[model samples]
Every structure is written in structure tokens, then in C-alpha cells.
Target: MARHIYVHNPFCARKCPYCDFYSVTDNFLCEEFYKAAIKETELIGSVITEDAGTNPLTDPDGKDTVYFGGGTPTVPDSRYICELLGAVRKAFNIASDAEITIEANPSSVTPEKLTEYRQAGFNRISLGVQSLDDEVLKTLGRLHDSKGAIEALKKISEAGFTNISSDLITGVPGETLDGIKRDIGTFKELGVKHISTYSLSIEEGTEFYRRYSGNIEDLVSPELERSMYHGTREYLQKLGYETYEISNSALPGYKSIHNSSYWNSCEYFAIGAGAHGFLNDLRYGHRDDVRAYIEEMNTVTYDTYKAFLEGNESFLKSLYVEERLTREDKMREVPFLRLRTTDGILLDEFKKVFGVEFEDVFADAVKTNLEKGLLERKERTLRLTRSGLDLANIVIEDFL
Candidate 1:
């Protein structure tokens, strides 16, 4: 099992209407909560290293990935960020080549901050440059405009950071195909190493959902959204970026190590308000309320938290409520996540992990999807075809 750490910064300058991630602005608590986060991370790191004993920090095979993700990791003061990174360094026997990533919003980062992040342990920066068009930026309620994004990209490169990834939002309301193409063109010119593009979804309780419920007519049509996905894939491929996952494109050897861990069913630790962690066959999330998390931290013992981590199976079942998955569910989920990558999943590997032959288990569902031209089997690996990529949810649901 791989050991990874994720530090979630729950502070944002302001929440985007479409965002449902745990975040707040009016009562920003970075000053009050950051130190507690560092302490939590120190405790978690000590546990992981203690479990490893004298061995290398990496699993026996030597693979470890650490990530700093957020509501704007750069929103807090640089010294606090450095202190948190320092804690990880002190508590864990980190591998020399450990991949350390920090997700930054364009508006929150400056040249000095990028330099400071580099001087600290972070080697990769994932910028949140949602869109390149001014109108789209306004509609999304992003704090930064296209110019700010461009400047940040330039600064990241200038600051001597070699691995840089950016986030792009597709199918935003009022966005045109040409506008998305322009954004891609801009990314190419900026020489970014990786790109993660996602189609906008309206989550319940978000402003987008509210407007959609009220019959808002400006959102992209389903057909147009599909077109955007296809167009973006083709354009990125032409620009020499490899499509590693459904929404991720990277230059050779620049894939996101931290994110790939989750897709590959590896375990990682999370720290901060609303932060989540998966380890020892368990998953756990901290309280979303910042005050609650801080107060609980003051009273909870590490052993109690360990016990809570052990209760993950029940917690996940309760959280998903009506949609509890079974053995057949594992059969579907294993392939569904694996097929998201271009490399796909090895049939033998799936069997090794799940204790059942892949074909013997889901032959009917596989055959149906293959006949529908949504799936393809190659060299003992089954994966989604180009058509399947667009209709992925529908195809994945067939097995469920």
C-alpha cells in the first residue's frame, strides 16, 4: 500500500457559485486553524512512519506521493504553508523523489508565493485557471481573469518550477466552442506541463443548481457539451499532450502521481477541516465545520482517531445511503475507474486484486457494451472506446 498525505486548505477568498467543496470566506479561519492542521499532520505522519519501522518511507517497492489540495492552498500566509511542509519532513521518512503537489488558484498566487512554495518542499503546482474568456470568468465568479491566469503561469515557469499542471472548466454556461479552443491555444503557448479539464456539473445547493432549477436558459446544451469534450481531446492530442485519463492530459512523464494513487486504489492520509483520508482498509473525513474540527482536535486522542478510521466501511455505506455496492459492485467499480486511464487495466491484475476472473464475473455486461461499440478488449485488457468516453456514466451504470 502506498502512503500519501493530503493537506486541505478550506479557506477561499469567496466561494464560486458552482462550488460545493467545503469552503467559507466570511469567517475565514486560516489564522486559527492552520497550526492545528500542522499538528494533525505531524500526528498522522508519525503513525505512518511508525508503521513502516526501519524500512524506507515508500512501500516495499518505493512509491509515495503527497499532495496539498484545497479551497486555495495559497490563500494562507506562506510561512504557515512552509511550517506545515516542515512538519511532514520532520515526522515522516519521506523518499527523496516523493511527489509533492500544491493546488493553487491563480488569484491567490504571486511570484513571491510561487518562489516560496518552491523553496519549501513543493515541486508541482496545479493552478485553477477555470477558463480563459472574461465573460466565462465572470459567470463562474472566479476571482482571477484570463490575464491573471497568464501572469501566474508565466511566474510559475519563471520561478524554476518544472512540473506545472492547470485546471480548465469546460461547458460552462455561455461558453462557445471557439472560446474553449482559444483557452487550449493559450495553454499551449504558456507551455504548461499538465492539464485537467472537467465539464461543469450543477450540484444541489449550489447557485448553478438553483438557477438551473429556475429554468435558466444560458447553460450549455448536452449536445454542445459533448462536442466540447471531443474537440478539446483532439486539440490537446494535436498539441502533443498525452491523454492519460478521461479529463487529464500531460506531457510525457508528467502524470499526476498523487491523483493516480486514488484511481489505483492506494491509501493516503488527509488533514484539515472536511479533509478525508483512506488507510488500513478504512476511510475517514474530518468535521466540515472549521470550529468543530479545531475543538475536536483539542480533545481527541490519536488512538481514538485510529479507531474512527477503522469504521470507514460503515461510514461510507451510511454516506452513500441508498447506493450500497456489493461484490458485483466491486466488479463494476474496478473496471470503471481503471478504464478511465488510457493504459486501462490488466485482466490478470484485476483478478489478482478481486479474487475472481474478470470475464467470468462480468462477461454479460462486458459483451453487451462491446456489442454496442462502447467498449473494446485488447491484449487481455478491457477499456472504453472513444464513444464510451462520452457515454461513460451510462456504460458504467449498466453493471451497477
Candidate 2:
């Protein structure tokens, strides 16, 4: 049972509109989160050991990847980053070449900070360079301007990070296919090894949703959105980038191992406020409230190992949402998640895990899609066609 690890840092300089992930604006209780994060890591370590029947201090199965995702991981002090990584290494058997990544905002990163981060064993850097156009960046409420993003990327490279990934967005109001192409070009020109381009979705409770809720036409039209998506795939493919996942393109071998773990539905450990984890067929999550996490972990009796040993469900319930996944639930997830990648689902692998033939399980769903040419089955793999990619959600829903 190889495991991936995720640690959430809830601090951010500010929240962007059209963003709904758990995060606290400004660096409030950041120090406290760091302390709690360490304790939570110990808790996960004990749980993994208990499940595997191994020593808690030394992980025998070893971690495949570790990711520090956030509100903005780069907003914290470098010492905090170093301490957290050190704690994870102490508690888990991290492989020598484990892909350790930290999400960074350009404005929050400096040359000195990059140096410290690299020295601290963060080999991959995912820069959130939303757009190259200043106006678009402003509309998105990002702290860094185009020049700042370029400078930060250069500093990251100069600091000796080769596995660099950048994030971009399409379907934003006032964005065009040409603009999307330019953004991708800018990332390539800057020598980014990987890029993740997302379609802008105006979720509820966000500033963008409040303003654009009634002004839907201001956003990119569905036809144009499809053009942008197709154009992105074509342009990136021409530039020697592989569209490994729906939103992610990578140059040769620069794919994000940490993220791939999630798409592959591998068991992983998660820590910090609003973090989620899956192991032993159960999913657990911390509440999105950072204050609750800090207050609870700041106590003298905050021994995560003790929490597990005593089966302290009351304390655990206060911190996390737990769910045991059902068989049907797992079956539906396998295809949906795997189809998001270029490799799609390996039929034999799926069968091995579920103890049933893939064809036998999804006969009707597969037959209908294959007839409609939305899906293809070549030997042992089942994948979505180019047209099918656009209607992925609708197609995947058949399984559910």
C-alpha cells in the first residue's frame, strides 16, 4: 500500500473570486496551523502503522509523493515549510525520489525563499500564474502581475527547480482563444515543465458569482469555451506537451506524480484544516474551520497517537468528516477519475481491484458509449474519444 500525503496550509494573502477551496485570507493563526499540522502528521503516521502492522516510527511501505497544497503554501515562513517536511520524513518512509511539491503564489515567493525551499527538499514547484494579461490577472484578484510572475518563475529556475508547473485559466470573462494560446505560450517561453489550465467556473458564495450570476453572457460562450479547450490541447500537443490529464499538460516526463495519485484513486494521508484523506476504504476530512483546528491542537493533551489508541471518536468527530465508501461508490469513481487522464482506465487493473470483469460490470454503459463513438476499448484499456472529452461529465454519469 503505497501512500501519497497532502498537507494543507490555509493561509493566503487574499482570496480570489471564482475560488472556493478552503483558505483563510491573510496569515492569521498560521503558526498555530503549523503546530497542528505536525501533530496531525503524527496521527496519520500512527494510523498507517496500525493498518499495516508495522512500526510507527519507521514506515516500511514508503511514501510515493507528498504535496503541500493551500490557501498559499508560499505565504508562510520558509522555516515552517522546512519543519513540516522534516516531520513528514520522520514519520513516513519517503522514497529517495519522492516527488515533493509545494503550491506557491508568485508574489509570496522570493529568490531567497526559493533557495530555502529547494534546500529543504521541495523538488517540484507549482506556480499559480493565472494569466499573462494584467487586466485578466486583476479581474482574477491575483497578487502578481505578468512581470512579477515571469520574474518569480526565473528565480525558481535559477534556484535549481527543474520540475516546474504553472496554472492558467480559460473561460474567464473577456478572455479569448488567442488569449488562452498566449498564456500557454508564455508558460512555455518561461520554460515551465508542466501546465494546468482550468475552465473558470463561477461557484456560489464567490465574488465572481455574485457579480456575474445574472450577467452570464459576459463570460465565454459554450461554443467558444469548447474552441478554447480544443485549441489548448492542439497548441500544447504541438509544443511537445502531452495532455496527460484533462486540465494538465506536461513536457515529456514532468507530469505531477502527486496529482496522478489522486486520479489513480490511491490511498493517501492528509493533514491540516480542511484537508481530506482516504485509506482502508474510508474517507476522512478535517473541518474547513482553521480556528477550530488551532484551538484543538494547542492543548497539552493533543496527542494524535493517543486519539487513535483510545478510539476517541468524539474528538475525531469534532475534527473530521468520516465516510466508509461503498462498493458501488468505488465502481462509479474508478472510471470517472481515470477517464480524466490520457491513459484512461486499465481494464485488467480495474477487474483485479473489483474482482469482476470490467466488461461484465459496465456492459450497457460501455456498449452504448462505444456505439456512439464517445468511448474506445483497445484490448485492456477503456478511454474517452476526443469528442467524448467535452461531454465527460455526461458520459461518466451513466456509471453512477
Candidate 3:
């Protein structure tokens, strides 16, 4: 009875230099990966059914969101995608109006493929446009240029998808405020309903880190980064896109339901290599190795799932690394997560879950930030002020 499900496809056409997500170039194993996903779904259904009466994570209703995130979910054959969706519906009770989304690269998807995907029950598409500049696209190792990205968006529209989201990155080497403005313009020109903007972070193993390790200022000045963020926020706001979450902006009624579930700290079921899930207060991740996943899942049988439900965690342990959250950890997580949204933290919900008043636990920190003009409290909600958003990580650290 998880409210959301995230299925990770661990294959990409080619790896982006700045990406650290688990993925491989192996397209040959797409069918095998889908099979593994189906098996995992069955295992989850068994676990939830057994614990339905007592598990806090299992809701009595049904799942309302399903996200096919990836290494490019569309890069594989569409038939596999359909099979996975079919297996998911069979394994869980899906709400009729559920939001089913898939992440795709501009170059990897075609109008015909998208039409097939739409037929398979995928109602939303998130394109990895990254940037609207050709040079920036090259710097980020994207396969499509600005023109190609726009054409893909056109085709997606032609394929009957109105809920389209574009992902863009800021603080790239040599990015300018004018460049960000142009990107936002491109999103509007393409009629995309949702936008997700992120600042570039040079991970240790990425090529960007290897090349520009200590010379980040040569990429984009810190002052310029700040200006670009504010500029993009202001411009998108003027264009009628609301910043519902720190990095997400959307037109009215176009917000990402799958992503909002995460910020709300809702329980979800995750499957496939490198996917993560939070259930019954335990957060867990699957093995990152694709071959290991396929081989292990091949050994799984119906009895194995039954064994897992009977307090035997050996099979589950072999497939995933699990962490059980403590009460303190859960409390610290709620405020920070809710603050990421425009609706902010709800006091009554916090009290219901933690059995204590919100102010009683965070009075000093809340008062300090409020005095500093970084946080604002409405009747039952508290959220970051405009000035606090860019430094959100810093403000949320107090809660942790």
C-alpha cells in the first residue's frame, strides 16, 4: 500500500560526465533487468500483504504515483517498459488517476516511441534537456543540442503529452545570467508545464571534478551563481510558474505528484538496481551491480518471498542494504523535508507523528531564524523566506 513507486532503469545511451547515478552502457540486458524488476515487485507485494494489518508504511488505500526514473527509461525497448507497468498493476492496487511518469533523454525518444509509452499508461514525461545552449550541452556531455531538445519536446506534444517537465542545470562552467534567461525562454517556447533546475555539484569521481577540481571560479563565479538563481526564479515566477519546491517550478495544476511524495516523506516502493525505498521506518537500497541483480533475482521463487515475510531477512539482506531510522532521525527529517515545499511544515501533522508540539522541540531554532527574517510562520505552517531558499541547506541544518 505504498503511495509511490520508483523504478530505476540502470542503462543509459552514454553516461554523462557529471552524473554519479548507478547506470551502465549495457543495452543487451534490458529484458533481464525488466524481469528482475517484476520479481522484486512480486516480493514487495507479498511483504506488504503479510504486514498489512500492522505495518505503518502500508496504507489501506492504494498507490497513486509511479515514476520510471533512470539511466534513461526510454533507451530500452518500449515492450519492456509496458511489461514492467503491467507487472506493477498486477502487484499493487493503482489509483485510477495515478500519475505515471518516465524520464527520458531527448535524443533517445521519438514521437512513435512516446506514443507507445502513452499507450502503456505513462501520462507524464520528464526530458533531460540539461541546458539550452549547445556549448553547455557539450560541457555536460548531453547527446542532444538545443535544437534537438526542442524538436523532441515538439514531438512529445504531438504524441499527446501535456504534462511535460524539463530539467536544467545552473552553475555550469561559463554559465551566465543571460544563458539562464535563454534556457527559461526555451522551456516556455516549448510549452513545458514543469521545470526542475539544479546547481552543478562536482562529485569526486566525475570528469568535471577531475578537470576543474580547484578552479571552479573559472567556471562560474560564486556571485554570478547567486544572481543566476534569483534571476531564474524571478523570471519563471513572472511567467506564471510557481516554485512549489526549492528546485521545481510548475504551472497551475502541473506539479510533479511523484516528486512531491518524496518531499512529503511518504512511504514508497522502489525496485531495480540502485533504487532506494523507505518502508516501515527502514530505508533500503538495492545492489548497484546489474549482473548481480539479474543473477540473484533469477534464483528467487515464490517460496523465497514467503520466507522473507516470516522474519527471515537473509534473502532481503542479500539484495539490499537496509537502515532502520530512529525516532530522532524521523523527527529531524520531517521539518527539513516539508520546508522544501511552498506549503511548508504543518504543525498539526508534525505533532500527530512525533507526539510533541513542534515549537516545543524547535523553539529556539525557529525563533532565531524567524528573527533573522529567514523563516516565516503562518497559522499552522512554517517555511523559508525568499532570502532563506538559496541557503536552505544551512537553515535546515539547525533542525537536524
Candidate 4:
């Protein structure tokens, strides 16, 4: 069995205006609550493994992917995060080549801490450097400027971390097409292995959403956003980066294994406050409240696990209230996610998973999209055209 694990760090030095992830900025609360949460997660994993007739304390096949994702995994005491990784190793079957990834904010990491992370079996680091322009960084309320981001990149490189990735946001307020191109050029110069460029969507309940909800004029225009995305994609491709996913580009053989697990609908275990896990087609998310999560573990019963799997949708809706997906959601999701890769989804695999022919499922919608020259069906695989990629959301929503 392929097992994956995720550790959530709900602590951050500060929250960006566009971020809606579960995080707390109060240092005192974070320092007090994170350790206990980590311990509880270890215990939960132990119990689950015992119940499933598997040994939690030993690696059988050595095939595991552990990911540290959050508001900022590196924001917590480096030692504490290291201990959590140690515990995961003790409690799960981890592969020798397991992909262990940790997410870091450029402002929150140090050269020494990064070196320590490397020693702690963390082979991958993802820096949240949303933009290379100081002005754009400020507009996004990011704590680190371009200089800081470059320094962080240099530190990771010097520490012998070759599998480093950076996050970039396009279409942010006050950003220009030239500025985005400059960011891409800088990334290429830095010799980073992977890049995940996301469009800035004003999520509801976020500070950006509240500030710009009624004022549409303050946001990046649709045409400009498309132009920025197109230019960025072309520029990155020229640098020998493959567009492996919608927002992710990677150097050859450096794609993120842990993130790919989610898109492939593979099983994984989650630990820490607000962390989520999927197993046996059932999903569960931990409580967001740090105190509640720590306490509930001691008292949590088997029924709690059942309730979690069944009730996850409601919790997800409350957290990401605006973008709720449905069962028929696969109509769009299947192609959208598959097209992100060079090897699009196999028709036989889709039939096995969904019990339907891929073409038959979206026959009408596919016909319309092809007529408009937005999609291509070749060699038993379906993919988006260059024009379709620019208007991805529009093409995707047709099946919805």
C-alpha cells in the first residue's frame, strides 16, 4: 500500500491579506500549542495502524511520502518540526527515497535552520516567494521583499538542497506583465528546480476579498491576467521548465511527488491542527482550534473517526465556503487536472475509476469545446489547446 502523510503548521509570523488558511499570528499561543498537537498526531497514527493490523513502528515496503504544509511549516521552532518528522518516521513505513517536503516563508527561515532541516530527512523545500518585485510583494502584504527571497534561495542552495521550489502569484493588484516576466527571468537565473505560479483569486473572508469585494476596479483586469499567464508560461517553457500541472512547472525529474498524490486521488494520512487525510476513499480533517485538537485526541473514540469521514464536506464548505464541488464535479475536474500533465489521463483508467467512458460522460460538452477549437482529443487522450489553457476556467466550467 502507498501511504502518504501531511503535517500542518498553523503558525505564521504574519498573515498575508490574500491567505485564508488556518493560521494564528500570536507567537505566545503558537509556542504553547504546537508541541502538544504534534504528540497527539503521533498517537493517532499509532492507534490507526494498530486497528488496521499493521505495525505502525516499522517500515514494510519503505514507500511513504511525508509533507509539511501549512501557514508556514518553517515558522515553528525548527527543532519542534524536526521532532515531528522523527516521530513520523518512528510511526510509519517510510521509503528510503520518500519525498519529504516542507513549506517555508522566505522571511521565516534561516541558513542554520535550513541546514538543520536538511539533516532532519527533509529533502525538499518550497519557498513562498509570491513575487520577485518588492512593490508587488508589498501590495500582497508579503513580509519578504525581493532581496530577502533571493537570500532565502541562496541559503537553500548552499545548504545542498537541490529539490527546491518557489511559489509565485500572478495577476496581483498593482502588478504588470513586464513585472511578471522579470520575476520568471529571476527564477530561471536562481536555478530553482520547480515553480508553482497561481493566479490571485480574491477568496471570500480573506482580507483581500473584503477590501476588494465591492471595488472591482482595484483588481487586475481579466485581459491583463490572461496576458500575464500566457507570457509567463511561454517564458518558463523557454527556460526548459515543463508545465506539469496547471500552476506548477518543474525541471526534468523534479516534480513534487506529495502534491501529485492529491491530484491522482491517492491515499494519505494527515496530522496537526486543521490537517486533513484521505484513506479508503474516506477523508477526515482535524479541528482548526489548536486547543481543541490537542484535547480531542485523548478523548477521541472510533465513532469520531466515522463522523469525521462523513462530515468532512460540511467542514470543508465552512472553511472554503464559496467553492463547493459536487459529484458531477468530475465532468470538469477530470480533464482540468489530467491536462496539467504531458501524459493525460488514460481512458481505461478513467473507466475503472468512474465506471463510465470518458468520451460518453462529456460527449456534448466535448463536442462544443472542440468546435470552438478549445480542446484536442488525440491518441485516446484529451487535452486543452494553447487557447484553451489561457481560458482554462471558462473551458473547465462548461461541463459544470
Candidate 5:
């Protein structure tokens, strides 16, 4: 049922102080991680074969999008990526137009590595160039300077990547509106098709949290952050990039297919440590620990797997169900996720998917938001108002 797959690479060259995502500086586990990923694909494929008659792709297009995401996918050997990709192809029906992407860091990617990735079927490269300002980059603890980030973008484009994306972090400690404009200008000049803007949030356990929690004023004030956010959004839109999602913009037709699958509630396969997927009325993922994941993948018995496939949830081993989704849970989640997109929640589409009218399920929240001018109905879509986008969390939570 899943038309997409995501593989998480947990090995980072060095963990950034601001990142809280599951990652380690250990490179020794890279080989073991890929092996377990391939093995996990095999096990998942075994289950899918029972349902798929002739092809693994359930989409009408007969294609699949495979994404290799952080903690810095480019840090590992390209051969490992190639082998795992080969295994994925064997397990799934990937058509020519399938959008395969790998997220890279400027500090980790090289021209040779980019070529191997392109040859191995990776058509999209998401380069993490968090800032174009040296001072801002330093404050964020990124290894690459502005020069390296620009060079990496050039190398990625040179390696025949037409659908390249670059990231920019707004609201950073030493960031300025001019700096944000400069970063956008650099990305635009480099022919980057997609740009994702992230707001700096100091989560607990990260170095940023330790440094700034006691004196939050060291970071941008709330009003300044808001100004930067709206300014960045408006500027990108003015530059012919559609703000397709809350924090994502793309030049025409360059939106991330794999990420869109998540927002649309389409099921996708998940592999490797910390990767998550939705399937068969459940959300499932392996433990975040690399060693734990490898051990579980290596030790699962045929009987247990068969039992697990048969719906005995207890038989689940290394990969455990995070949540058993109910029909009600799904109805609530649909609007919550869809509202993040520019298209918003399609009223007819909601009924088509859930067998009930959207208004009937969420009349109260919709009416409240509409009254508050936080929601607007454009044609058949219920999208966020300009004010609603700023207070998206509140409106989204109303649906949940």
C-alpha cells in the first residue's frame, strides 16, 4: 500500500549542538546499519508480497519515491548507499520517474560521492546549508563555512542534480534579515529548486538548550523571529517559489514527493534506526539505538515474523508498533496534517478517503476558526488564513 520508502542514516560526521534528531558520531556502525536496513527491507517485502499480485507499487503511476534522510546520509560510503538501494529496488517496483532523494550535509558531500549517488538512481539532493553567513553558521555550530556550502551546492548541481534543495535556518542567534536574503539569493543563483526554512528551536538535551535556556534573550526575540519568518516566506513567494507547506517552498513542480506522501497520509515503508512508517492500521518503527536495531534485525525468527505478519502484534520484535490507529484517530489526523499544505484540506477529498464529510466531523473547530478569521474556504479547500498560518499549532491542534 505504501508507494514511498524512507531510510534513516544515524551516523553523523559530528553531531551539531542544535540537532536533537537521533544520530551518533560513530562511523564504525555504518556497515552494520546498511546490512540491517537491507534485511529489514527483505522482511517487509515478504509481508507485502502476500498482498501485491504482480507489482509492489500500489500507486496508479507504478512508481515509488525512496528517500535517504539524516543524520547526514552523505557521511557513509557511497557503495553502502548503492547496495542498499539495489536491495530496495529488488523489494519494490521503482519506475523511471520515481523520485529518489538523499539528504546531504555540505561538510560531508563531495563531487565523487554526488556522482555515485546520481548513477545509483538518486535524482534529488537536499543539501543542508543551514546558513550562508559565517557568523550565523558558526553560532549554529555547523562545520561548513559559507564558502564550503556554496561550493557544495555547485558540486551537487555540477553532478547533474536538477532537483536540488538547500536548507536555511531562520531565527538563529546571529542571523539577520539581510543574511536570510543573502542565503535565498545564493540558493536561487545556484539553481536550487527547493528551499526549506526552519525556525531555530532550542530543544532540551541539545547544546543550544544548555547555552540559551537560562537566558533566552541571547536568541532573537519573538517579534523579531515572527518578522523574519513572514519576510522570508513573502520573499520566496515573490521569487516564483510556491510556499507549498508551512516551512517549505519549491520552484514549480519541484516539491518533495516523499515528504508530500507523509502529509497526504499515504502509507510509506520505513527502514533503519529511528525511521517510522504507517501500515495496516498501525504506526511502527525500530528503536533509535543502532546496536539494538542491528541485533533485532539479525535475530528475528521465521516463525515470529510469520506470526507478526498474521496480525499477532505480540510477535513484533525489533520493529514495534508505536500506535494502533483507529478510524476516529485517522479522521482527526487527516485535517491536522493536510492543513499544513497550501492546498489545505479538500472537503470532497476528505469524504472520499474517510467515507464521511469533513464538516460533519469537525464542524465545531471549523466554525470556531472561521469565526476567528483563522480559517478560510477557498473553492472546495479549507486552508489556513494568513493569521492562521502564524498560529498554526493552535488551529491544527483543534482538529487533533
Candidate 6:
């Protein structure tokens, strides 16, 4: 009954070396995985419907955002994707202006697939462009080159997708500021309204991590990263793109509703292998094993959803982990989460949720940061200034 839903597609045509997301390149498991996902969605809907008014988890207003993210959701056949989307619709009352999105890779997306997705009610398409420099793309282990990515963007736009997003990784090897400018220029030309920028980090368990474990600076120096970060912000703002989050920008009314919901600390239901969700004061996630997820959902009992709601550990012991949190934990987390956005925290909403004024709880922290010029206030909201965003870890730690 959550207002937002996140579906993690675990199939990928090929795994990127820098990606640590739970996904498999085994094409054979694709069909079974999606089928199990459909079955699971139906189970969730039925359980939510049964408990309708009585359950605290219920959100009778219906879902306004459904995000299909993953290891390249377009890797599988379009039929499976479409069928799964249909199952989601059948399971919930999607709002009339719902924003349904799909994450796609350039190498796997096709014109026909785009058409089908458009017809299937996927209003948004997020492309994994990674980098527009061919050498950088190769270094990142992405399957598509700059040319292929551009062509794919054109195809998505031609297929009538106006709400297009492109993901870019800054600080990548062989990337220059001029190259990024060219890429952004290309995106502007091709009608890309949203841009998600990420600084390449060598997370543990990734190929980049192994390759640059000791010499992380060789991958991307801190100074270079800072230059790119600020430069990207300035250029994007100049081009009329609003920097909504620390790493996301959108033109006018094109900001991502689904992603923004996360920044606001909204609870959502997460589906599929390795998907994580937060609801009713509990954070839960499925194991990263796709095969295990498929088997569990396919053989799941009708009481599975109810058990999940009740926190019956025995019912989900094999493939799920539920983290129980206290009221204080949720309260302390909301401000930090909301501060990630440009709009910052709404003081009245904060008080309504926690029954305490924002200043009463953390007046010292706010006063400290404000005195240091790392925080700013606009009428009824408080947010990080440009300096605070640069030193975010320092500012955010005080909240924690």
C-alpha cells in the first residue's frame, strides 16, 4: 500500500566491472525470474487488499510512482517486461498521473522495445549512458560506445519518450571537463530532461575496487573530482537545469518523482532479488541470489505477504532480512534524508511526524552549522548551503 514501488530487475546482458548491484548475466533464468516476480506482486496486492482499512501499512490513495530499476531492465525480452508491468497494474490502483519508469542500457534497448514500453505505460526512461567518451566507456566496462548511446537516446526520443534521463559518471579515466560538456550538450540536443551525475567510487567488491585498492587516487584524484563536481553544477544551472538533489538535475518540471520520494524519506515497497524496502518502521531486503529469490516466490504460500507485514521471521528466513527500527531511529534519519534535497526539510511536516519542533531536537547542530555558514534557511525550511554540500559528510555527521 506504499505510495511508491521499486522493482529491481536482476537480469543483465553483461555485468559492468564497476557495478556492484545484485544482477546476473545468466539469460536462461530471465523468464522464470519475471514469472516469479509477477506471482509475488499479486500476492502482495491481495494481502494489502485483504487488510484494506485495518492495516497501518495501507495507503488507500494508491501508488503514484513505480520505478523499474536494475541491472539493465531492458536486458530481458520486452514481453517479460511488459507482462510484469501489467501484473503491477493489476496488483494496485495506479494513480492517473503516476510516473512509471524503466532503467535501460544502450546496448540492449531497441526501437521495438521502446514502442512496447511506451504502450505499456512506462512514461520515463533512464538510460545508463555511463560516459560519452569511448575510451572512458571501455574503461567502465559498459557495452555501448558513445555513438551507440547517442543512437539509443535518439531512438527513445523518437519513440515518443519526452521524460528521458541519462546517467553519467564523472571522474572516470580518460574523461575531461570538455568531454562532459559535450555530452551534456548532446543530451540537451536530444531532449534529455533529467541527468544523474555520479562520481566514480571504488566500492568494495567491484572490479575497480580490486584494481585500485591501494592506489585509489590513480582512479580519480580528490581535487579533480571537486573541480568536476562544481563545474558540472555551474554548467547545468546555466543551462536551465535545476539541481534538485546533490547528484541529480532536471529541467523545469521534469524532476524524477520516484527518486525524489526517497530523498523525502517516503516508505515504499521493493520487489525482486536484492530489492530493499522500508515500511511501517522496518527496513527489509531480499538476498542477492536471483535463483533463490525465484524459487522462494514461485513456491511462496498465500500467507507470505501477511507474514511479511507481521514480521514473521520464520516465514521469510530463507531469503529475507528485516531490520527493526525504533521511533527515534526513524526520526533521526528523516532530517538527514530530507537535507539531501535542494528544497530541504519542511519544518511543519517534521513536527507533525515526530511531534517535536525541529529546533527542539537539534538546535545545537543547526546553530553550529548555521554559524559556520554551512547551513542556510529559506522561510520555513533549512538546507545545506553550497559549502555544506561540499563538506556534506561533516555536516551530516552532526545530525547522525
Top candidate (TM-score) = 5
Return the lDDT, model 5, position 265: 74
For candidate 3, give the lDDT of residue 216.
Answer: 63
For candidate 2, give the lDDT. 0.82
Superpose all Cα atoms of candidate 2 onto the true structure and report the RMSD in Å to 1 decimal.
3.3
Q: List the candidates' TM-scores in order.
A: 0.91, 0.93, 0.93, 0.86, 0.95, 0.95
Q: CA lDDT, every prediction?
A: 0.77, 0.82, 0.82, 0.76, 0.85, 0.84
Task: Score residue 109 of candidate 1 by CA lDDT.
Answer: 88
Q: Would you list the rank order by lDDT, best first?
A: 5, 6, 3, 2, 1, 4
Q: What is the C-alpha lDDT profile of model 5 across 87-149, one tens digit per residue?
A: 887788666788899999999888899999999999999999999999888998889999999
lDDT of 4 by residue, 1-400 (tens): 4567888888888988999898888656665456665565565555565333221322223356889999798887888888888888777756678889999988988988998999999999999999988888998999999999999998888988889899999998888778877877787788789999999999998999889999999888989888888888888898888887789999898888777766665556777777877653445566677777656554655455434443434422211122334546544566766666555556766776677888898888789988998888787777788887877678778766
Which 10-residue span in candidate 6 carries the lowest summed lDDT?
51-60
Top candidate when judged by lDDT against the true structure: 5
lDDT of 2 by residue, 14-53 (tens): 8888899999885757787798888777665655553442
lDDT of predicted model 6: 0.84
What are the runs in model 4 whose C-alpha is more than 4 Å off?
48-63, 301-333, 339-342, 352-356
Each candidate: RMSD to true structure? Answer: 3.5, 3.3, 2.6, 4.6, 2.3, 2.5
Q: What TM-score does candidate 2 get on C-alpha atoms?
A: 0.93
Q: lDDT tens string, model 1, 1-400?
A: 3457777888888999999998878445676688777767666654554553221322323456678887778888988888888787666666768888988988888888888988888999999998999999999999999999999999888998889898889988888878877887888788788999999998999988987866746778888899999998888888888998999999888888887776665556778886776555445566677887776666656665544554433322211112334556546766767778777766877777678888888788889999999989898888899999988888878766
- Itemize residue pairs with steric clashes in candidate 4: 62-95
Query: If candidate 3 were superposed on the true structure by all CA atoms, what would the RMSD be?
Result: 2.6
Stretches of candidate 5 off by over 4 Å are 50-63, 309-311
Clashing pairs in 2: none
